[model samples]
Target: MTQDEKGQLKALLRDEPSMRLHRELEKELRDDMMQRLLTVRPDDPAFAALTQFHRGCLHGLHELWGRREQFVKQPIQGGNDDK
Candidate 1:
């Protein structure tokens, strides 16, 4: 990720509860993937597919997090300031 992407992720993590949950879930999934991959043989195609799937999942989670952050930062309706 670029520095700007990193900054956006940090901001999202600060303001969005769902983003925090996503990051925690992603960390757990990554750890589980690592453990499962360790049991697979090097030549196994399933192992490669699993790794690729996790990569895609992480990428999607990051994109969602960025969008959610932008959403949360937007002004609320009725001219509310409490949000």
Candidate 2:
């Protein structure tokens, strides 16, 4: 993450309002992904490629969400490490 992004994340971790907003954002993203996945047709030629792309997108989103949750759960100490 960039230094500015890291600083913003730290600020979010320390602020309840920002944390709540993050949770809401995550929920919205997940819901939107689900909607898009549901719209994909299994018989379409593009199905396989689209499915693969969606899977990767969801996986990345989940990973980032998990990381954010972990960051918020733990106390913010000065560190560059993501995990």
Candidate 3:
């Protein structure tokens, strides 16, 4: 994670309004991904890869949504130390 991402995560953890905004963004991204998935033709050469990418995104979103509290309690490991 970049420092900016770490900061954003912290904000999301510490502020209810930040988290609500993050949720709205996530919902928008999910809707866009679903629209893309719907428009893909099964016969297209990229179909499998495209669907797999969206599936991975969906899984990640689900994981994040379910783990917000856990994330709030622990710092994500890959970001540059902000302290």
Name the candidate that leads on TM-score. 1
Candidate 2 local Cα displacement, residue 29, angstroms = 0.7
Query: Which stretches of model 3 miss by more than 4 angstroms?
Result: 1-23, 34-39, 76-83
Candidate 2 residue 66 Cα shift, in angstroms, is 9.2
Flag regions of model 2 displaced more than 4 Å. 1-12, 43-83
What TM-score, computed on C-alpha atoms, does each candidate reach? Answer: 0.58, 0.40, 0.51
Each model's lDDT comes to 0.77, 0.70, 0.76
How many clashing pairs does model 1 include?
0
Q: Estimate the overall C-alpha local distance difference test score of candidate 1.
A: 0.77
State which candidate, 2 or 3, has the greater TM-score: 3
Number of the candidate with higher lDDT, 1 or 2: 1
Q: Model 2 reaches what TM-score against the true structure?
A: 0.40
Q: Is candidate 1 or candidate 3 better by lDDT?
A: 1
Give per-residue lDDT, candidate 3, residue 45: 67
lDDT of 1 by residue, 16-76 (tens): 6765687798899799889988998879998899889888988887777667656555645
